[model samples]
Target: MSEKIALGNWGEELVAKKARCPKCKNAKTLKKLTQNFKCADLICDFCGFVAQVKTSSTNDINTLPNSILGAAWGPQKERMDAGIYTSLFVVLRSKSDKNYSIFFLPSELQVPEMFVAREPLSGNAKRAGWQGFLIDTTLVADRFVRLI
Candidate 1:
């Protein structure tokens, strides 16, 4: 598998093992959903809480970045229009020590202003014309709940 995929899988595994569901308070109940589920990566089987996980290797695990690249813009926009927003789990791995710090951004704190649409993919690229987004962490930095 690609390094990106492996890193993502490792981050998800860390979350599944360490993070507890805010709703149900169960750590083991969080299941990794398929990649097809664009809106979320982990789901709580007990409370039905869904969260999108973003993993990044950073120099400082204690600090959250100003921006985080997000998934497809279309589905996120659709959900935003319908007033449905998934919670976010940001997993930051220390580049030097390889320790992880997980932060949770509740769905209630998410807003359209936090999602900035990215330019569409080039025609020559696979999945041409597909667009993504970036989560503007500056907008909700103070609201994140540290889970680990």
Candidate 2:
């Protein structure tokens, strides 16, 4: 098979391909999971590292320049522990009105767990104080430039 393949799901096509493992730097072990959440999950069998990509449901993608798009997380503690940061965040563009969506990628977008005070947070998330990572979009612009 080729290095990349388009997997269809829910009548939508998922562009899937192998990804590099951030932990072990293994090129072959990381592949995008086409099932489950419909986005992408970078899972590395070489080091047991896994991360998810979440697509925004909202149509209004025109966000303020260099701002956070949103936040998300897996309910399982195991996944959280495996992640570099317990919380995750997505960033917006620096300046643009176009509808550009970003994913809350792990490994690359990790934050210190302590900084996230979940106990003081209150929202729809029943998990605790704060659920997702608090990130500044400016710092992550370079990392997600391809997506932008």
Candidate 3:
């Protein structure tokens, strides 16, 4: 598997093993959903809470980045337009020591300005015309809850 995929999987596993559902506070309730699930990676089996996970390797494990890359822009835009937001779990992994941290950004703390649409892919690319978004963490930096 690709390094990106492996990193993401590792982060997901850490979340599954460590973090409990914020809504229900149930242990081991977060289950990995199918990749096809739009904008969500894990779901709370007990409380039905769904969240999106973004994993990144960084040199500074103590600090959260200014922005986190998000998945498809279409669904994100649609959800924003409808006033629907998903909870975001940001997993920061250290590049040197492989240590990691988890930060939870609740849906209630999210705003429209935080979702920045990225440019579409080039026509020659495999997923040509596909677009993504970036979650501007700077906008809600103070609102994130450190889960780990």
Candidate 4:
């Protein structure tokens, strides 16, 4: 039997199938677990093959021309206060090198900071107020997928 794991409120689920290991080619032995609710860390137990799962369910967001530049999350207390469990600050980079950092709720994209241009944020800048480059998440439309 396969294990059905709920990937939080992203409306995405991981159906752990008994498939061949990508490295060893062993049959029906792959298992996966996430380190966070964001499902950022998906690992296979057999040959230690790591795979990234797409979290977006919409084509619009998936088709966005923008790219992720940076990301951050509120403190636990702040997250609970906002009535959002897993929140993030997503920094988006356009093709023209224009960067904007937006406060990303688990359900939607909010609080965008506008600037003509943005750099990679120095350590001092980050300490002051910048979250720097998030550069990991690829599913843009997943921001709009919400659970209420």
Candidate 5:
């Protein structure tokens, strides 16, 4: 059997683990879990934060220089023992058993640095604080929040 093949560079760039988890300050433990990046330390769970999470990163989402095209959302669990905060609010979801889902911004818009949008009937609001979300703006205006 004979096969013919032809191609240049597949018009692709390798995602060479170009980033690190700001919470744990870890780079070697990054793992691509589906579309989101997960921490390799299954037990650590210090932060199951997204790896190449573009929307959350300061360089991508913050400095868009236009309407807020989009934003990343994730829930974090409390890890008080781990000496770090965790994700708990279901930001991108409804009152269901499923996990959070990603939402898109069709147009550019401005959102408050401390934006917290939630459902009207989501019971989670009572349990979790204002935004079960975290934004480490203590050091910088657009730093990532500690999530799990």
Candidate 6:
């Protein structure tokens, strides 16, 4: 019996938040003092249901697919909790070769500028862009997994 520390610090609250919802398949955002992992403007994938997720729940976000990670899609966009679910289509430029190689981001991120693509893609080009070679993500991942 020594010290009775009053739990009043903001950082303390973040330590308490551990519960995650497996049904929704994700973890809560870092404790933002706002509590409750919510997205009031968020729309559902299975149904048209609109609601916010309580961040207090202990959800292991890594269990979900990589499609939802750090991504904001659709009209409203809203906000989302990220994990392995987030992915990005990054364009890297090689000065020596003077070519652009589109790589998946985060995991594939390297030194910036040095790893930058040849040029920024215009919206028109993005819609109908062709890098000549068509390498599918699924194919690459599957091959890698087999090698492992």
Show where candidate 1 strays beyond 4 Å. none
TM-score of each: 0.96, 0.36, 0.97, 0.30, 0.26, 0.17
- Pick by lDDT: which candidate is best? 3
Candidates ranked by TM-score, best first?
3, 1, 2, 4, 5, 6
Q: Which has the higher TM-score value, candidate number 2 or candidate number 4?
A: 2
Give the better candidate number (2 or 4) by lDDT. Answer: 2
lDDT of each: 0.90, 0.40, 0.91, 0.34, 0.27, 0.25
Estimate, for each residue in 21-128, the C-alpha lDDT of model 3 and write its tens digit.
999999999999986689899999998999988999999978999988888999999988999999989999999996889999999999899999999999999999
- Scored against the true structure, residue 114 in model 1 reaches a CA lDDT of 96
Q: Which stretches of model 2 miss by more than 4 angstroms?
A: 1-18, 37-40, 54-109, 112-136, 139-148
Candidate with more favorable, higher TM-score: 1 or 5: 1
**TM-score of model number 3:** 0.97
Worst 10 residues of 2 by lDDT: 7-16
Candidate 4 Cα errors over 4 Å, as ranges = 1-12, 18-20, 37-40, 60-148
Q: Candidate 5: give the clashing pairs.
A: 67-108, 67-109, 68-109, 76-87, 76-88, 77-87
Tell me which of candidates 2 and 6 scores higher on TM-score: 2
lDDT by residue (tens digit), candidate 4, 26-68: 6555454543433133345776654333232223332432444
| Model 4, C-alpha of 112: deviation from truth (Å) | 25
Model 2 alpha-carbon miss at residue 32, Å: 3.1
Candidate 5's C-alpha runs over 4 A off are 1-16, 36-47, 50-52, 55-63, 71-148
Residue 60, candidate 5: how far off, in angstroms?
Answer: 11
lDDT of 2 by residue, 18-135 (tens): 2345568676775555555311344566776665443333335544234332244333334446653421223222223434444444445544342232333566657556444333
lDDT of 6 at 13: 30
Best by TM-score: 3
